[model samples]
Target: MSMMVNSPLYPDDVDILAGALYAWCAERSIKLQSQEGLFAANVAISLYDAGYHTQDQLLGALHNYEFH
Candidate 1:
């Protein structure tokens, strides 16, 4: 399932990453509301593009990620 997200830079495969992020967050009980989902999707896409291709990597990134 593809999640609808609004972001500035969406790559061709962003939806795939976003869906993975949605599932990842869901598994962790993270609440990514409608508005916040856009940012979460963006972060997910960035991580995916950066070569962190697994949920565990994303989970670790989320733990160490600092919002600027």
Candidate 2:
């Protein structure tokens, strides 16, 4: 899912990714508050867009619960 940066609807992408991540987490028995999970997903996406082009970067973002 691609989100248009700097657009009014950009924040909506956070919700979209959050929902997907939330479901994935739930399936894995990971308990994440809605806001926390959403922020984590958003940070992952941001790090990706920032040219952190590696699996490690993605994993780090997801595992870094202090992001929010």
Best by lDDT: 1
Number of colliding residue pairs in model 1: 0
How do the residues 1-68 of candidate 2 rate in per-residue lDDT, one tens digit apiece? 34334334355555544555565466556566666555555665665566544554445555553542
Against the hidden reference, what TM-scores do the models get?
Answer: 0.51, 0.42
Candidate 1 residues lying further than 4 Å off, grouped into runs, are 1-20, 27-33
Q: Write one digit per residue (lDDT tens) for candidate 1, span 27-54.
A: 6576777455556666776776577666
Model 2 poorest 10 in a row by lDDT: 1-10
Candidate 2 regions exceeding 4 Å error are 1-33, 61-68
Please state every model's RMSD to the true fold in angstroms.
6.6, 7.0
